[model samples]
Target: MVAPKYSRVVLKLSGEALAGSLGYGIDPDVVNTIARQIKEVAESGVELAIVVGGGNIWRGVAGSAKGMDRATADYMGMLATVMNSLALHDALQKHDVDTRTMTAIEMREVAEPYIRRRAIRHMEKGRVVILAGGTGNPYFSTDTTAALRAAEIEAQVILMAKRVDGVYDCDPLTNPQAKKFKVLSYIEMISRGLGVMDSTAASLCMDNKIPLIVFDLNQEGNIKRATLGEKIGTYIGGELNGEGDH
Candidate 1:
C-alpha cells in the first residue's frame, strides 16, 4: 500500500454526515461504513484525530433564534456532540481500531475531558482521538473547535468531510451552474464567504498556515483517499498562489 502524504490529520466531520439521508440522529449503517473507512485510514499509519459537529442532533444557533438562552443552547449542542463521539467510538471499536473520545466538557462517565497532551499521546500511540464538545464554550462553532484542536495538536492538515464534493462558488444544490474550485487561497475563501467554514475557523487556519482539504463524505473510501493525499477535493492553503489554477 502507498504511504499517506500527511502523517497527522484532523478530520472535521459534520454531524449531518453521520445522520445519513434521514437527516436526524445516528444511522447505524452509515456509522459502520464510516468506521470501516476510518479503519483503513488508521491501518495505513496516519495519526487521525476527529472533530464532530453537533448539528445533526442539536443546532445551538437555531435554538437561540427561538428564544432559548444562547449559552444554554450551545451547551446542549456540545452534549449532542458527545453522543456522536460515543457512537463513532463504538463503531470504530467494532472494527478493532483503538479509539478515545475526549470532550471539552467534564463528563468523566462518558469520556475523558480534553487535554492537549493526552490527546497527542493517544494519537502518537496509534489510537484515533475523537474530539467533541466544541471547545467547551458558548458562541464557538465546532469548526472553530476543529481549528483550535488541530493547531494545538499540530496536525499537518484538516480534512473537512462535507456532503458537497468541493468548494463551489454557489450552492451546488441551488445552482447547477455553480463553479467548483479545485484550488483556492484562504483569502479567496474568506473574502467570497464561500462557507468553507465559519470566518473564525478560516482565520485561525490561515494564521497557522495549515492546509485544508474539503471533500465529499458520502463517497465510499473518500476518507482514506483524503488521508492518502489523492487530491479528491478542493485544496485550500496559503502556498497555492493559484499555482495549480483551475
Candidate 2:
C-alpha cells in the first residue's frame, strides 16, 4: 500500500460536498462515503484535522441581510459550521473511527472548546479532529480557519477538497476554455487572483511554507489518493512558476 507523503494533514471540506447530488442540506449517504474515505486515511496512520464549511446550510455573507448586521450574518455562518462538524463527528464515529469535534466558540453542550494543546493531543492519539465555528469570530471564512488550524497544528499540507477537480483559470462550469492548473505558487495565485482560497488563507500558508492541494471530493478514493501523494489536482506551494509546473 502507498503511504502518505506527510504524517499529518488538514483537510478542508465544503458543506456542499457532504450534500451529494441533492445540492442542498446534509445527505447521509454522501457523509458516510466521505467518512469511509477519511477512515481509510486515518487507518493508514496519518493524523487528520478536518475543517468543514457550512455553505450548504448557510453562507452568512450571502444570506438575506436586509435588516441583519454583517457580523450577525457571519455568526450564523459559524453556527452552521458547528452543525456540519457535529454531523461529521457522528459519521466518523459510525465508521468506528475515533473522532473529536472542537469548536472555536464555547459550545460545551455539543463539543469541546478549541484548545490548541487538546487538539494536538487528540491527533497524537490517532483520533481525527474536526475543527468548527470558523475561528470563533466574524469576518473570517472557513478557508482562513483551515489555514490557521494547519499552522497551529503544524500540519505539513492542507487538503482543500472541493467540487471541482482542480483550480481553473476560469469557472470550469461556465468556461469551456478554462484551463486547469497542476501547480501554482502563492505569489502567482495572489497576483493572478485565482481565488483558490481567500487571500488571508493563501498568505498564511505561504508564510508558513505549508502546501495546499485542491481537488474534487466527489470522486471516490480521492481522499486516500491525496493522502498517498497521487497527483490529482492543483497544488499550491512555494515552488510553482506556472501551470502544471509543480
Candidate 3:
C-alpha cells in the first residue's frame, strides 16, 4: 500500500458542493459519496477535520444585502454551517468512521464546544473532527475558519474541495479557453485576485505557512489522491509564480 503523504489535513467544503445538483439543500447522494471518500481517508490513518460553508442554506452577505442586520444574517449563516456539519457527521457515522462534530457556538445538545487541545486529542484518537460555526463570529467566512483551525491543529495542508477541477485564470464554466493553474503561491493568488478563496483565508494561510490544494470534489477518490500528495489539482504555497500558461 502507498503510504499517505500528510498525516493530518483540514478539508474545507463549500455548502454548494454538498448541495450537488439540487443547489439549495443538503443532497444525500452527494453527502454519501463524500462520506465514503472521507471514510477511505480516515481508514488510511490520516487525521482529518472538515470546515463546511453554509451558502447553500443561507448566505450572510446576501441576507445583509436584502436589508437584514449584517451580524444577525451572519449568525444565521453560522447556524446553517452547524446544520451541514451535523449532516456530514451522520453520513460518516453510517460509514463507520469515528467522527465528532464540534461547534464554536455553545450547543451542548448536539456537539461539543470547540477546544484546541480537545480537537487535537480527538484526531490523535482517530476521530474525524467536523468543525462548524465559522469562528463563532460574524464577518468571517468558513474559509477563514478552515485556515484558523488548520493553524490551531497544526495540519500540514488544507484540502479545498470544489466543484471545479482546479483554480483557473478565468471561470472554466464560463470561459472554455480558461487556463487551469497547476500551482500558485499565496501572494500570486492574492495579487492576481484568483478568488479561489477569500483574501482573508489566503492571507491567513500565507502568514501561517500552510499550504492549500484546490481540487474537484466531484471526482471520485480525489480526497485520497490529495492525501497521498498526488498531482491532482492546483497546489498553492510558497513563493512561486502562477504555472498555468500551458
Candidate 4:
C-alpha cells in the first residue's frame, strides 16, 4: 500500500483558480476536478483541510484601491469566499467525499462556525474540512487564514495550489527568463518579495515553522503527488530546511 508523506495538510486555493477561462464566478467543471483530486487524497487516509480565496468573485484589495471603505469591502470579500466554499463543498459531496465547510464568521445556514477542536474532530473522522471567511475579520488575506489554521491544527504542511507551477524570482507570465526555485527559506522568500503569499501570511508560517509547497493545479495528479511527497513543486521552509534566520 502506498503511504502519504504528510499525515495531515492544509490546501490553500485562490478563487481565480476556480474561475477557469471565464475569468469570473465559480466554474463547476474546475470545481469538480479539484474536488475529485481532494477526494482522492482524503480517501488515502491523509487528513485534509482547505482554505479558499475570493479573487474571482470579488477582490477586497481591488475595491479598497478603488476607494471603497476598506473594512466594508473586506467583509464583502469574506462573503465571496463563503460562496466559493459552498460551491466546492457541493462539488466534493458529488464526488462522495465527506466534507465540512467551516467559516470564521458565523453563517449557520450554510457552514459551521470555525472551531479549532471541532475542525480537527471532523478531519479525524475522515472528513475533508474547508475553511472560509478569511479569519472572520478584515485586513487579513486567505493566505493568513491558511497559515493560522495550519498552525492551530498542527498540520504537517500547506499545499498551495496555484496557476503557476512553482515559485520564481520574477513573475513567469511576464518574465520569460524568470528562474524557478525548487526550494527556499522563509527569510529568502520575505526578502526577495517573491509575492508567493502576502507578507503577513508568510511571516505567520515562518514563525510557526510550517512548510509550504506551491504547485500548479492545472496539471492532473499534482495534488496527489504533492500529498504523497512526489517532489513536484517548490517547497518553502524555515531555517531548518535551508539557510536563513527564522
lDDT for each residue of candidate 2 in 1-246, tens digit (9 for 90 to 100): 777877999999998888888887999999999999999999999999999999999898786366678898999999999998999999999999999999999989999999999999999999999999999889999999999999999998999999999999989999999999888888988899988888999899999988989999989899888888888988889975442354
Sliding window of 10 residues with minimal summed lDDT for model 1:
237-246
Per-model lDDT: 0.93, 0.91, 0.94, 0.92
Q: Could you tell me the TM-score of candidate 2?
A: 0.96
The root-mean-square deviation over C-alpha atoms between each candidate and the true structure, in angstroms, is 1.4, 1.9, 2.2, 2.1
Q: What ordering of candidates by lDDT runs from best to worst?
A: 3, 1, 4, 2
- Per-residue CA lDDT of candidate 3, range 101-137, in tens? 9999999999999999999999999999999999999
lDDT of each residue in 1-246, candidate 4, tens digit only:
679988999999999999988899999999999998898899899999999999999999999999999999999999999999999999999999999999999989999999999999999999999999999999999999999999999999999999999999998999999999988988999999999899999999999999999999999888989988887779899855332211
Error of 1 at 117 (Å): 0.7
Q: Which ten residues in a row have the lowest lDDT in candidate 4?
A: 237-246
- TM-score of each predicted structure versus truth: 0.97, 0.96, 0.97, 0.97
Question: Which of the predicted structures, 1 or 2, would earn the higher TM-score when compared with the native?
Answer: 1
lDDT of 3: 0.94
Model 1, residue 106: distance off in Å is 0.7
* Best-to-worst ranking by TM-score: 1, 3, 4, 2
* Model 2 CA lDDT for position 121: 100
